[model samples]
Target: MIKVIIFDLDNTLYNEKEYVISGFKAVALFLAREKSLDYCTVYSSLLESFVINERGKNFNYLCNKLNIDKSIIRRLVDVYREHYPEISLKEDIEMFLLELSRKYKLCLLTNGWLLPQKMKVESLRLDRYFDTIYYSQQDGLDLAKPHPKYFMKILQFYKIEASEALMIGDDPVADIQGAKDLNIPYFQISNELDDNEKQKIMQFLHNNI
Candidate 1:
């Protein structure tokens, strides 16, 4: 039986692309003011880079394309990370959490930079739903998901065995693999869940939890 439910933050409860877009808008505005460039163009370039899976190099891509100083890349990153993201959970997700919180212990396990993750939790008001929220970066990136230690930490905190917890997340590697390594049961879902997927998750809970 599942006594605790562990959730990944990005692309699980809410769409991670929304957060990326929101951060891009914030950085674009900041860059536009500092470099006298058009905000639309800057934002578009950032989005395009992201769409192409630029990964950690979006700022560099934008700077090289726009002839902006490379020295400012760090500042742009800071702006993106520090910005208060304009994001919200979907109504269905909100209701799902409300319902789940009433029944089982809910915990959030996410891997990301500390401040941005904290902002996301604050923005979504995840505190209302989750009994505990673990940011893996607090323990260092090496301790992030796919490493069994953080997962073990969560289990230890709740004083529950791995078999008693359910991991839900979008990433096949970080979230699912981590749970798998510890023999924790998991339900894989997409970043954005449609009606059918939501129903399937509910069915899984009913049958398993």
Candidate 2:
């Protein structure tokens, strides 16, 4: 019997697009304030340099690409920390996560850094529910998600059989298929996917579940 459910943080537990928009606006606002650039221009350049360059997960690359001056990145990170504490369970999530916790040994398996994720979780007070939160950076860059090793580490660390646990998350390539490859039950949360995208998530969940 499945006894554990591991949830991915960020969009998986909330409306994901809103989080992206807010983060973008935060970065854009900071850039505009410090560099005297228009919000749109800074947001655009940010998209190109970070997303297009596929450095979305790399903060150092973002620091360089944004021309972040001394202490700017730290300050902006602090800004994120300030705003993040206010972002809590979206829509049905708080209840859902709570309900799941009652029936299962629920954990959080996320693919982000410590500061931002920590602030968000702390602010949400979700620590009261989930038994554990495995931050990927705790294992270093090479062990991050989509690499297979990371997911396996979590499963082994918890002494969970792949068949005895479920992975619920947002990312398509990372959370979905990574857990799938390990023969675990996988569910994609359709927090912000469009109709077509929702169908894709449904299909994956339907097939896997």
lDDT of each: 0.91, 0.69
TM-score of each: 0.93, 0.65
Per-prediction backbone clash count? 0, 0
lDDT of 2: 0.69
lDDT at 153, model 2: 73
Candidate 2 lDDT, tens digit per residue, 28-125?
Answer: 78767867868897666656665555534434555576665546667665655455644556545565566667767888877766777777678678
Judging by TM-score against the true structure, name the best candidate: 1
When superposed on Cα atoms, how far off is each prediction in RMSD? 1.6, 5.8
- What TM-score does model 1 achieve against the real structure? 0.93
Error of 1 at 7 (Å): 0.4
Candidate 1, residue 54: the lDDT equals: 56
Shift of residue 27 alpha carbon in model 2, Å: 6.7
